[model samples]
Structure formats: C-alpha cells, structure tokens
Target: MSNFARVRPIGRRRDGRPIYPIKGGSPTLTEQRDEVMRLLQDENYDGDVAELLQRAERIAGEIELAQQREARLRHLRGLTPPGDPDPNPGQRQQPGNQPDNGIPDPVSAAEAFVRSEALRAFRERGLRGESGAVEFRAAPAGTVTTTTQPQQNTRVPGIIPQNPDFPLLVASLLDRQTSDGTTLEYMRDTSGPQSTWNKAAVVAEGADKPKSGPFTFDLISTSLKTVAHWVPITRQAADDNGQLMGYINGRLTYGLEYKMDREILTGNGTTEMQGILTTPGIGTYQPGSGSTDPKLITVRKAKTQGELALYPPTAVVMNPMDWQDIELDEDANGQFRVIANVTDPGAPTRLWGLVVVTTVAMTAGTALLGGFRTGATLWERQGITILMTDSHADYFTANTLVVLAERRANVAVHTPAAFVKITFAALP
Candidate 1:
C-alpha cells in the first residue's frame, strides 16, 4: 500500500505545512508493529520519509504497551478476547475449577465482548446519534467462556491548551463584598453633598445668634445585577473533547470578567447596573490649556475633587492606548516625559501617587479616577460559575450540552463625588 494511502490531509498552516487529522480507533499491536517494519524497510527514504518511519515506531511502541495493559485488565475482570475460549461455556463452574475465594468468575467472555462492542458503538455513534440500537446473541450451552479486558484509560498529552491573552481588569482593585443582602443601602447627607467647617468668632458669653441646623439624610439604594453568558456544545464535545474544553472555558471566563470590568466603569442603569461614570454627581476634570501631558493635570484635578468631598482618590483607570501615549510622550529636547530615564525598571503602572489601571474597558479618550474603597462597593452575589447541562431547548434530544458561565454583582457608588471622570482628545 502507498505510504500516504491511509493518511488524509486535513488542512495546511500559513507556511503550507500539511496537517493531518488522526483517524480510526486504536489498532492492534501486531498491525502497528508491521506498519513500523514496512516503513523501516524503505532504504531509499530521505529526511521526511525517515521522520514518518520514526513516528510509526513510536506508535508501535505505544500499541505494544496498550496491549500489555489490556491483557492485565482482562485477567482481572475475567473477560475473554476473540480466539481465547473459556473452558466452560454456559455450564456452571465445577468446584474443582472454582477458586477458593467466594467471588464467582466475573461475566462470561461472551458477555464481556458484548459489553465491549456496545461501549465501542457508544463512543463512535452514540455521540453522533447515528445509531442507538444494541443487540446481542446468547452463547450456546457448553460453549467456551472467554475473557475480554476493558481498555485502559490513557490521558492525552498537552491537555491544557495555550490561552489567548486577556486584558487585566481593574474591577478587583476596587472594594468588593460578598453581599448577603440583595440591595445596598447607605445614608447620604441631603443638606449638602459635602461637610463645611464654621469658624467661631470670639464674642460675648451667651451668643445665641448663630443657629446650626441638623444635617438632613437620605437613604440611597442600588440593586445587585447579574452578568452572564452561555455556550452550546455537543455533548460529545463536552466529554470526548479534551484540550478544547480548557480553551473554551478559559476564554468564556475571561470574556465575562472583562465585560464586568467595563460595566463597572460605564454601565447604564436601565436593565443593567449603574457604573461609576453613570453615577449621579460624580466629579469631572479637564486638561490645562497649554500642557501637552495631561497625566499630571488629570491626577491633580481628580485628587482635588475627592479631597474636596472628604475622600481622597486612590486609583486611576485609563485605556491602554492613552497610557501608551503618555509613556511615549517626548519633551522639546526629545527626552521621555513619563519615564525618568531609558532604564526605568518596570512598566510604569503608578502615576502621581495613585495606582494606575490600564485597561481597554475605559474609552480610548477617557479615564476614571476614584477612591474606590471609599466611594463605591462591588457586591458579588455569585462569582464566576460554570455548569454543563442539556436542559436548553431540544439539547437533550439533540445530544448537546450548554456550558454556562455567569456572575452576579453590582457596583454602588455611595459617594459619587469621590470619583472623577476625565475626558480628553483621542491620541493619534
């Protein structure tokens, strides 16, 4: 047979390297060994042909090991392989043939073969719904009892696939709580958003002139919101698929987390939770008239706003693109403005005494500065959860499983004035 006869090309890489999909169930050791020998006999083979022979040898070795394991398993389970006849067919075992141990011989070889065949059918067609029927014939009386061992469970290498890089979220940097209560309630002073200090004048003994009124308070509330997404996968894919599950679940979790982060920064309070940017009466800042670098001005204004509200801003969140612009900004002399020197150690994540969080969630031309722990709270009803079920419509009949990943949380900014939103021109 031609060397490439059994191999079917699946696709090619960008560089045109041919890719082949592995086909067929596990082969017998003798078949694998013979294939390897045939490849070895090709003396005129070059580098690629030699590589093929090497792969065949490796496969042969694996098959031999598998056969040994199969034999051991068969011995333990009292199953018989084809061509191996049990001395007793359908008759009850004689005491002489029976072991002293009370346990009777496992299932007869025929029963084992039937089970094996059924399992093979399940693996091949049950997942695809090609055939759901299984049939078996009774072994004739006095027929030899054969033993067949089940297949060993061999784990595939590289079970964990490489994951795509996901944007790190700043949501965790803020104050978080596992809320037992569904809604967040806090008291807000209505008399004024901020507290004022009054200086007492040195006057007469019984000065009853100045009258101070009690501060008015209003209760503020925000409800917890649920964020979720679902992926529908064939039940076969969920079970038989190895590395693929890792990739799918990881990507799904990352996607959900990134969305939550963005919502905390910009979610509108209609059906979704209200975010810091949408929080009523939050602070705002604008860049100075002539300054090319807005980092300094941004931090100053935001910090000043929070300080004015009696809450000092502790973190700055901006888009990666904007941070890049700031980091690469040059002065008249061609020297970097943000980095002190060329050898500046790590990625500059700190600026103007505030922890800088660079994420794509923030708009390209906008930034948010806030005293996260003091101004707002993240109440998590449920963390990221993953589950698989066929309950989705028609999925049970269709052999499909729904992989759901979801989170329930809400962002409540009790002191909106303690946060600041800075909008600037989009960098070129």
Candidate 2:
C-alpha cells in the first residue's frame, strides 16, 4: 500500500492515459511554470530564434526578388504583367499549367481551342449538294430536247487584248488591188490578210492620190546691215491721236528728204562730198490745213579732211549752236577735235540741227583732221523715232501706221534673208 496506494489517481484519463499526480492531479502550476522558464533559458533558445527570423527574412526577400524578376522579363518581351482578369491571356500561363489563380495566354490558348471543324459543318448545310459530295453533275442529255434560255456575254466591250505578236483586225471589207500598183483603200482593211470580212466596198479606184507638198516654204535673201535708232516719245503724245498722227507724218516726210540727200552725196566722190544742209520748212503745205509745225531737225554731214601726221587721229565732234557757223579753229593746248561740228539749232530757227561731220583729228605738232571713213553711210540707218506733240491725240490711227512702217524697215534691214526648199519622194 505505501506511497503509490496513497496517491490515488489525481485525474482520470478519458482514453486510459493517466493525468499527472502533482498539484491537484495536473502537473503542478509551479512545475509548469518552471518548465516554461527552463525552456526560455535553454542554451539553444537564442540560436533557434535567430534561425527562424533569418528564414522568414530570406523567404520575404526571395518573394520580392522573384516578383521583380518577373516584371523585368515581361518588360523585355514588350509585355506588361496582366491584371487580375487578363485581357491578353497569351501573355500569361498556358492552359494545362495554369495555377489556381493564374491567367491564360490569350493567343496560344485561343488557337488551341478554336472550333474550325464545327464552323465548316455549319457552312455545308446551306450548299446545294450533299454534305460530303465532291463532284457536280451536268443536266441529263436532252431528254425532251428542252432548250435552256441563252445567257449574255458578261465580258466588257472594246477591251482588245494587247498581244505583241500580231496586229488585231478591227473591221474587214471585200476589195482587190487596182491596176496602178495600188490597193484601193477601204474601211477595216487588215494589214496582212483579210478574214471574217464585215465591210462592203462601194467603189474600186485605181491608185492612191499623190501626197501633197510641204505646207511651208523658205525665202533666201542677204541680210541688210543697218543701224538701230531709239527715239523717245512723250507719254502725252503716246496717248494722243492727233499729236501722234502729226508727228508721224512729219517724220516720214523728213525721212524721205534725208534719203534723197544721202543719195545725192553718194553720187559725189568721197573727197568732193562736203556737208549738206537740211532745213525744217521743206515740207509740203496746203492752205487751210492744220499740220504739225517742225520744232527740231537733225542733220548729218560727211566731210573728208587730210591724212595723219605721226599717229592716226581719233574722231570727235565739237559742239555747235547751229549749222550756219562752222568753227575751224582748234584749242591752244592741242586737244584735237575729230568731228567738225555738232549743232542743235535753237527751236524753230535752227530746229535741233545736229551736224555729224566725219573727220579724224591728230594730236602731233601740226594737228590735222583725217577723212578716212569706213562702213556704210549713216543715212542707211533703220531706226524708230517717237515724237510727242503738245496737243493730245489717240495712238491707234496714224501712230500705228508709223510704228508698223518703222518695225518693217527694221526687220528688213536686220534679218538675214534665206530661202528653204523641201523635197518629197513617193515610196514605190
């Protein structure tokens, strides 16, 4: 009986495992507290706690690094990680391998589960033939010879094939060669041979008509060498008809007179030809008819002085008031004057007279005027001179005539005259 008998079961075991006997049938409170304290004070306690904390920290770091690496890889592939319900399933996990909370790859998964065969079965029901038949049978050969309606040609008209080897015949006609070694021209005539003739020839002629000559011809002539003159017309006279008409009439009459004088000078020898005088009042006048009064007139004089002293003299003209007084004296310092005189007579009296005397002046001790002249005379000049009167008149009437005459003369003088001939030969 002893101490074991005295220690009755402190706690009954439900499944036959006996409870502790210290301190009211449970392990004693002091002993439990002591065990907990002993565990806290154990030698490996700090090491175990440190190992657990390190393991937790490592797990957290690994999760964070894995998420970062996934994000980086997605970025490199030009993709973004999908949201919860992904729009692009192809960017996510595959079908069978998808996790419980994983998304699917949109492109690859859709291709894998496509229903193409089902769609084909649906289309077959609408066709005329049986579901799986391959050949189409023609209508039975003329049981009653029932004629089917004719069908129209669906091809577009006039679209000729551009075959490179042969020319396409558009139309054809019936005709033969004539006696003059020429085939009578007909519509739709094929180049090589005639077949499927659709046109009829109305008449059969001999040979083809001879081709006509060239449409243009050329004229051959020498170029008339002449000088051009530019004359300024006032704006007022250009706008006025009466003033332009009067100026043109006066200029023409004056031009003709100058031509006569030039011809006379040409008749005379070079040395014998002295300076010729041109007066302004030498125009035809009618009673009671109003005409433009001449205000200025230019006179060109041809003169021959002697030969050169030492060096040839350059030509120059001395200024003059009018043609009346010709100054023969030279300057004291020996500045030689080549041209004898250039005079612009005052208004009506001298009438803007310019005496262009051809003379060459030398600069040596005995200064002399040379008379060697080259080229055509100045009178053969082709030029236009526009004059303005104080009175206003329209430009089209008489002014147009004057302008045309001047232009014609200029063209005749400057243009080289040449003739062109064209030769055409018929092929045999």
Candidate 3:
C-alpha cells in the first residue's frame, strides 16, 4: 500500500454506520498499547492529566446528586395520608406528624373541639377562666375537709367552662365613669381607710364553698380617678357592697364674654371710668396672638382745652379759650358710648379723643358655661390653643376618643364585717 493508505483509518464502523474518532486520531492496537504504557511510565507527561481526572470526578458527583434527588422525589410520592401508621416501625417521624389517613384521632379531635369551644366562649362573653360563680357559704360547725379532682371529659357540646363576663362588665362600668369627677371621689372612698367593701369575697347561690379567694374590685376604684374630669358628675353615692347607688346628671358648660367702654370729649372736657373687664379665673395674662397680651387700659380721664388734659393734648396751641369735658355714659341703644361734654362753648372747638377701653370676661361657675363656650369656640378654630409662637403651637384636645360600656349583674356582696365564698363545677 501507498504511504497514505498505510496510515490507520480515523473511524470505526458499527453494523455499517461509521463512528468518527474523538480527536481525528486513529492508532493500531499495538500503537495504542504502546502509547498507554508510555503515559504510565512518563513522569513529565502530567500537564492536564490531573485536571481531566478532577473534571471526571466532578461529573460523577453531579450524577450521584441527581440520583439522590430522584430517589427523594420517589420516596415523597410513596407517602400515604396523614393519621395512617408508618409501614416500617423502625422509621422515625416528627412530632405532630401523623399518617396521611383522612380520619383524625377521636381523642385528639375531641380535645381540639373542646379547646376551641372554650376559647370561643371566652371571647364571646368577654369571660376569663378566673371569673364567674362568686362563692358564699356558712362555715361548717365541725372540721370539713374538701378535695378537688380534674373532671373527665363529658363530650358535651357547648358545656366547656368559660370565663364569666363579670370582669369585662366591671371594666365597662368603670370606663363609663372615667370622665366623672364624682367617680373619682367615690373611688377615693373605696381606697380610704374607712372603705366598707375592701377585699371581700362574693358568693353565688347553689355552689360549693370555695377556697378563700381575695376580692379584686375593692382597690379598682383607684384606677377610675385618673380620667375623672371627663365623667363630670355632680353627686355620687355607693352602697356597702361596692355598688353605685345614685348620681346627679348634668352636662358640662363653658364660655367667654367681652365688654367695651368708650368716652367722647367736646372742646374742653374730661372723662374717667374703670378699665376693661377680665376673665374671672385668669390669674395671669398669656401673651400670644389669641390671648390678651396688651390689656385694654380703662379710660380714666378725657380732657379738652386744658393745661393738664386727661389725654395727651393733640392741639398745637391756637384757640379762642373754649373747652368741653368728655364723659362715658350708657346710650339709648344700651351700648356704652363716649358722651359729649355736658357744657359746650359758644363756638365748636376741636373735638379731643379720649382713651378707649376693652375687656375680656371668662367665668367658670357651676354651669361651666364660660369654659364650655371657650372650649367650643377654640375647638372650632381647629383645637384649643394653650400657647403659640411664630412657628410653634400647643393644644389641649387629642385626636380621638374611644368609649366602652357594659352591665354587671349579681356581683359579689361585700360589707365592712365579712366576706362570702362559692364554687362551681368546671365545664367540660
């Protein structure tokens, strides 16, 4: 064969179709064997051989990982329904883990229902486990020991024990009186040394004698004192049992009024009067835009054509020696006015102006009319302004108010002398 033909073919045939060599290289069996032996023997031929081995290992690792993921997916698909027992006893399961069975355990289901129902009852009536069934019983003549045991499940619907609404009711009652001043006074009575119903037990009829439980509502009156202003009650009375007996009902009122005094002077006249009216309880003037910083000075005197005039002389000293004195008087329209001088000169002289008077009146009495009016007016101006600077301000009212109320029935009976105790069976 020629040299070209002597070279080995670079492809192989499998049942007639040709399969090309990977790198266009073809070697005889003897040559391939010699090349493999040379690679094993040559220490200098180690350039990319380690890298190729590492790449092969990486591919093997990927294949193993893929196989593991496939195995996990198959295992997951084989899982049964919850509540179903595991097929293999040796296999461990997580807590709360149950078989895939559709049916839940009877015991667990019953317990869940009971718990859910109990919670529902507690929320519906605003009850707490510690509430309800205040106890009262005459002490036994002899030694009487009592024992308690956890009640077994009775599987009765709507029979689970719940917190009575009494506590919530009491809270609501106290909230209703939060704004009443008399409520605070009553609260103080409950807290004072002479309190009649402090730390007394309440007992309900048809119940076992309960273990001694201290009273809760006695000291609660103190909390009501904080918001007493809003409650605004005139009179309040409570019985020895810590119950509200009666109260005076009325609305609070407040307002502000103003009066102005003025006087007029003729050619030669003088007038004298008291200054502007002021707020009744206003101890000090608040210097601000809306407040009376520059108090209105009263028109003490108004004089005309005189060396010492009541007011500063406005004339430049040129006249025929005529004068009138101005005076403050009530006009026919009932409005205060500057009256003309009683005596007038033959010829009309230059009219002299007298001092002007302004007044602010704020009266807070039993009616609260002044304060309420002021509050309303200020509220209409957006909010009550206690004080304000060029760019800063302060207010008394807040953004919102929330009110809640409730009625409590058959509360515990308490007096200065003794207390009562009662108990009842726990709900299932």
Q: Which stretches of candidate 3 lie over 4 Å from their true place?
A: 1-60, 63-67, 70-80, 83-86, 94-428
Which one wins on lDDT?
1
In the range 67-186, model 2's lDDT, one tens digit per residue, is: 899888775544534453443533432223211101112222112212124323423542443222111111211221114332222322322232222111110000101111111111
TM-score, cand. 1 vs. native: 0.53
Enumerate residue pairs that collide in model 1.
79-147, 79-148, 80-146, 80-147, 80-148, 86-145, 89-143, 109-146
| Candidate 1 lDDT by residue in tens digits, 267-331 | 99657776889877777877766545455555666677667766677778998887877778677
- The sequence of per-residue lDDT tens digits that candidate 3 reaches over residues 1-428 is 45564433333233333334445555444443444444446565543577545544655566678789988876765455577655332222222422211112222221222123332342333223232111111111122112332222223331122122110111111001112121211110112112322334566787665453233324212111111112211111111111111110011001100111110001011111111111111111122344321111111111211212111222111111111111333456865454444474221222233111111121111000011111110001111011101111221122111111111111111111111011111112
| C-alpha lDDT of candidate 1 relative to the true structure | 0.59
In model 1, what is the error at residue 230, expressed in angstroms?
Answer: 1.1
Poorly placed runs, candidate 1 (over 4 Å): 1-167, 188-216, 234-237, 240-249, 288-293, 340-348, 392-399, 425-428
Between prediction 2 and prediction 3, the one with superior lDDT is 2
RMSD of each: 26.6, 51.5, 38.1
> Lowest summed lDDT over 10 consecutive residues: which window, candidate 3?
248-257
